[model samples]
Target chain A: MAYTQPHPRLSVVSNSSHSSVDHLSPTTTSRFSLPSVPSLHSSITTTKPGPNRPNIYDRPLNKTRSAEVSASAFAFLFSEVVQYTQKRVSGINDLERQLNTLGYRLGTRALELMVWRAEGSSKAPKRELKLLSVLMMVHTQVWKAVFGKGADALERSVENPDEYMIIDNDPLIERHISVPRDMSQLSCSSFTAGIVEAVLDGLSFPARVTSHNTPTVQYPNRTTILIKLEKSVLEREELLK
Target chain B: MAIFSLWVINKAGGLVYQRSFADGLAALTSNEYLVLAGTLHGIHAITSRLSPIGSSSGVQVIEGETFKMNILLTVTGTKFVLITSIKDPTADSVLQKVYDIYADAVMKNPFHTPEMPIRSEGFDSRIGTLIGTGQT
Candidate 1:
């Protein structure tokens, strides 16, 4: 974490005493074998050992699952979520925004895990063009993971072309929400919106997700999240076969 | 069995809400309603304390003119007192429907405080519909 401004190789020679073996590691290749690291370009220039350096991304993500959690436990947890967004917001729109962001972030991690735990392992896509298909897969799979069922509906916006909406009836988290008072504007299911955004970003879809209230009998809190794709993504999609 | 109105008592025995669906039951002043809630809360608490297992099957069957205000309660010990003057015997189901509406509109509402006064629009409106439901 200590990111000191690294002095140039020529400048370090001015400190003549401790500079004897200043740049020896790269200059003198001993028995240490280092693989070709693209981001490790500056390693050859460091005169002093960058303290406490270890590869951070080398560790696995899923450390462990809590032994006690079950289906009922999730329902209660979802109840708490319904309560959490109750206060500390302006109106229904803000509440929905918050919920959308939560859902989107959860979507990100869920997408990665879903792909990893699939019947066939997935290779993470590197380019934007190959990512829309991945994005669709993420919407379908990750929605099923968190919401307990696949999304009720999905459609691209006709006029805008870049906008899309993923519909969910009876989002489990919203089952317990009974928004009160001046906040009777919308359900507090914006947490789901966050999870959706997370999945989109994780799959390199790069879109914004906002939850809209669309209530039906079987699906009271039918959230239709409008996702507006970034221009770069549209261009990439057009370029791809 | 019949009901004419509904009242909810908080855990501490405070009467937070009261609404009459029928004509037999008279309205109480705001302060009187509060006093009533407190008294009922006390009674429910005293009854619960009488139990060895710490559960109160709260006060029911407050008989009135050609009508009755029967009480049901949530598992959390909050009272749901319903008043009805209906001649039909199937009055219990009406109260259950009230609870269902409460659970969906009020309990599911993030803005609703559990065991507090029922102030949700969805809740109040739905209850209004349930009360006048075939009572022509």
Candidate 2:
């Protein structure tokens, strides 16, 4: 309720400042005096004390694109997250599932933020109405925004019409993570798979996404994110076609 | 220019990881390796105390006839010891790189417990490649 309410005091201050500017003559003395009113008003409004800290929504979205966390720092944080998830799980699969759940929450937020960023201040933001277009967007824009590079490949499965894959030669999430001999089946990229699934789900695609370690001799950390669409989605696609 | 071996000791003077690159050095048993780590850790502490200046860092470089040992003690008390050829000038730099790799591969590993023996294949292969490149 507090957040939804517009600041009456702020609007009143701004209105008075605008009216004052109109009354002032276009002289150097007026110009010098003019800044003092707005500056005083701004200083009072901007520097709100204690609990009135600006929320994320209050901040500008178009921040520096080049802003990055050091890879080592991310690795350390991710490692701790994995270890924390591992503590509560019964087995490797359970651990991966928990990690996926953790990523799913992040995915929803990431999708919304990505869409918002793409829309900018445009009155009419374009939406991906088709399946292929949405997948391409994820494979390119979403992947680039999240991992700083586009996925290596996106291909539809030959056997399954509803199945698709997004391949990354070296997924950034698992770059430093090496699965031990006993847990060779465990792919840390399952977290990324969850993110992809959430993105699709957010767009009403209703798909299940999973990550597989499809390593080659050249790229030992190669990962393929497998997406399986629901029957309803496929039927809708056909209807749209 | 040739690196012979590397050893990592945890804060409590336990051998967490050990690897030998060269072939000429006589092989020691696993127990001996642990003992060696503990002995070196003790000597390090003793040497630091022996220093005339107050609160000096312990034995960093131990020079021998055939090989030299360079020790890097991290802020967290983890020790990285590199054994290189007697005349090798890049031992310190190589140790620093090894520390970087250890921080990345071992410390960042989700499966790795703090101060535990590191068994990650990524750490092994990277170190192997690093030492291998250094040899050539």
Candidate 3:
């Protein structure tokens, strides 16, 4: 503060009109010091800070910022959506199908945004991909968007080359669903159906999306969206690489 | 006013849901309720298209002086039938509210099975209270 103060000849003290820089001609007003300031003053001047911070912000460590959202608001909106789709549908299949279709559309939009976010000013995941590579994209990109975490596992079907399943432990979509007896067979994982569908579709691997419940030790609401890829998709994967 | 019954008929005049909320209608077998739904569905269709020009075919109020019969039809050719002996000015509002509840809580629910009996969690419990209160 003492070294940076302007020459007394250019004294302007207004908050908005400040150009607070001055040099000591006679004396720059004896270095103003508080009773408990001697120790703090030396530390502040000696610290080799990475960069000089602007006056607009507080100390570097205290300047953290992030957007905030209310979880209850999201839950309420989701509840309304679930209620609306319940009106005309007949069976469990239809309910799950609707949720899946909704999830798939959202998945497409999320995938696009995620790619943009990750690839900003940097080389992104290139076009060519093995099945494993695609799974990684879904894990790191799509899963983060949906559940705030990547999927638990992506397993290739042992019995069938055309089949793969992305496992989500405690899927967010199933959180509000308390299916009734009339819909005893209905699983609310269909919302994830749409998301997984979008990922496969984006990867040029056309597939059917289906959600089924798999209760477990850690997460009871586990959902595995089974993606059965078309034979042509495999061929395209080969040709692209 | 006791709610005599509620029926849901598809466009094809098939019974999707039928339940008795009162004791007036002679107790019918499960098969009979289904048949009643089917029969009412057919009658509703005949009445809707029976007109040469067009038909409003909805909320046909049958004033029973003490009680009232209400037959409501959706645009998709589904009918919601409610029979009650309560005469109140707010009866129509109550009925409309029921329809709104069904559309929002039941129709939009991703868990609701299409063309199936309503089994949504909020739909069932909430609609149950609304319908139950209206009956009293």
Q: Give the best candidate by lDDT.
A: 2
Model 2, range B86-119, lDDT digits (tens) per residue? 8888888888999989888888889888888999
Q: What is the C-alpha lDDT of each candidate?
A: 0.65, 0.88, 0.67
True contacts kept of each: 0.64, 0.82, 0.27
* Per-residue accuracy of model 1 over A1-241 as CA lDDT, tens digit each: 1334455443665666356666665555542454455226556646434555434464343332212346545655666675586465666676677666666667777766666555244465333247555556545766666655677777877899888877777676665555544554665556777777786777677887776778778665677777888888888878875
Q: Can you write out model 3's per-residue Cα lDDT over A26-116, one digit (the tens) per residue?
A: 2334444353475576777666453675444344322322233454456557766767776657666786788778888888877776665
1 or 3: which has the higher DockQ? 1
Q: Could you tell me every candidate's TM-score relative to the true structure?
A: 0.65, 0.84, 0.46
Docking class of 1: acceptable
Off by over 4 Å in 1: A1-75, A82-101, A120-139, A184-187, A215-220, B22-32, B43-58, B73-75, B86-105, B125-136
True contacts kept of 3: 0.27
For candidate 2, the per-residue lDDT at B26 reads 75
**Interface C-alpha root-mean-square deviation, candidates in order:** 3.1, 0.7, 5.1
Docking category for candidate 3? incorrect
Tens digit per residue, CA lDDT, model 3, B6-62: 666666766666656656556678787778677766666566676677664533766
Q: What is residue A37's positional error in candidate 3, in angstroms? A: 56
Cα lDDT of model 3 overall?
A: 0.67
lDDT winner between 1 and 2, please give it.
2
